[model samples]
Target: MTDPQIERKLIEIMRIINESDRPVGARIIADELRNRGYNLGERAVRYHLRILDERGFTEKHGYTGRSITLKGKEELEEALIGDRLDFVITRIEDLIYRTDYDPVKKQGNVIVNVSYVDKDDFEKTAGLMRSAIDYSISPRVGIFEEDSEDIFVPTGKVGIATVCSITFDGILLRHGIPVKPNFGGILSVENNEPVVFKDLISYRGTSIDPIKIFLMRQSTSVTGLLQSGFGTILANMRSIPQSAVENASLLFQQLHESDIGGLLAMDNESGNVLGAPVDVGMSGIVVSVGVNALAVVEEYGIDVTTRPVSTIMDYGTMKPL
Candidate 1:
């Protein structure tokens, strides 16, 4: 087996090359690594690059430097799996910290979930998306047909950006209400009402977003909910300090008036929200997930790959679905 330290250094080298828009030289890679707190010199970086080349993880570009190979990306993902464990919670916290969106001003950066779909299915997808939006955490969204510096649209596909429900958590946190994201799950619905979670995956226990797993398994019945008012949709559970319940409730009202409404239920007395228990001082709350719109499209036999908590975009740029 390779020395763990050396292996990490190689991975970091590939990561730097992979993220670069063009091939990167050893000096550039070395400087980037040092910036990341890795103390590899240009000479040491060249040696590591040779190992990556030998392993078919990188390819040389006529001395212009080196670019990561397809194998490099695969290897990088696999090598980082251990580090990715329990990453969802960290991502949530990061997005929350980055969110500076103001409901009253309706301006600032908010988190969004990006979904890639087949271009041929765009028309039908839009219709289904509107239906799903009615059941989603937010009614606003952004669509992209062409790739840009910030948005990557694959060939023969379109990209849709939906408001993530976590925006609510960020809003609450910014307002002095401590928000604790608990889990993402398939929420059961009857007569268009959220009942309970059919399955739960804690954010702190998963490598990827739980909603992505549920969607991949086709576990949600968002289409069913749209057609018959009975099925399952994506939802998330969170908690807040009991003392902040009133303030949080008021904030939610302001959000709703601003056209951002997805509060399913808030429970403090029962210490539970839709069967998920809350701690003694925390109040449980459930909100409709933003990805439910994409789930509906998926249920209709349309293919979609979702990137939850994908990126932050200015709220003013988004338009209603």
Candidate 2:
């Protein structure tokens, strides 16, 4: 097995190349590494690159630069699984780093927004964000507009909203506003592009009981969630606080073991609640890239019309009814 240090650097190199539109040089990688706080220089990066090349993780293209190989891609994907878990835990720890913070009362979560010019990269970014978050912090996705009135660049952008409690419909069950499960109902909204509105609103709809399975709502085509420019966020539906998660240590331990599915409900087996977020509101993930959205007009299948990730402006933090 590769040493931990080399393994981390290799992952970064593969990610950099993957994120780039074309092949890149060691100098480019080195510059980025410096920007990202890595103390390595170009020569060191080149040395590592040679090693990776010898290992068949990268392919050299004459004088242009080296690109990652299939082996490199698979390696990065496998490494990402572990990184995603660490990222989520670190995110939660960052937010709740207060003295008087309560792990109960309000639900807290993480919001991650990343936009890409390339469609495939966009979907991959969304998947990474979702996988990193959904196991712990309940994420809600959308296109977000910053709380400002003087910027067109930042306005009407769909982004991801990862939160602790199920806002609007799901959590409102406790407030006595019963949100029924949307078994087969497709809500239509005029004059809006793809953003997370009715999907979250309806999916958040749960029966009065908090412990029951949320009648799953087919938000958009499962394809839409993984589309290029517009990505659907995988959110969690949790009413209970993380503190209430029984045997959470074991849950986190399980997280270290295998690929835990991205749902935020309590474990039926161990009955462990693997959440501790206390602040219930919207946290914004600011991403930039967007293309003109096409109107979705499907009556039968998922309506790709309102792209949730496209319309995720932080403005509309849907309140619990």
Cα lDDT, model 2, residue 305: 19
Q: Each model's TM-score?
A: 0.79, 0.30
Per-candidate Cα RMSD to the true structure, in Å, reads: 6.9, 15.4
lDDT for position 132 in model 1: 78
What's the lDDT for residue 270 in model 1?
48
| Ten contiguous residues minimizing lDDT sum, candidate 2 | 286-295
Instruction: Give the residue spans of candidate 1 off by over 4 A.
Output: 1-83
lDDT of each: 0.83, 0.37
Give the alpha carbon lDDT tens digit for every residue of 221-281 in model 2.
Answer: 3234334434332333323333333443343234233321233233333221222122333
Can you write out model 1's per-residue Cα lDDT over 1-321, one digit (the tens) per residue? 699668867877888999999999997787556434355678999999999999999999998999999998999989857756755676578678778888788778878888889999999998998877877877778888755334667688888888888988888889988898998888899998889988998888777788888888889987778889999988898899888999999988888866788889898664678977778888888988888899888888988988887767787888887
- Give every collision pair in model 1: none
Q: Best-fitting candidate, measured by lDDT? A: 1
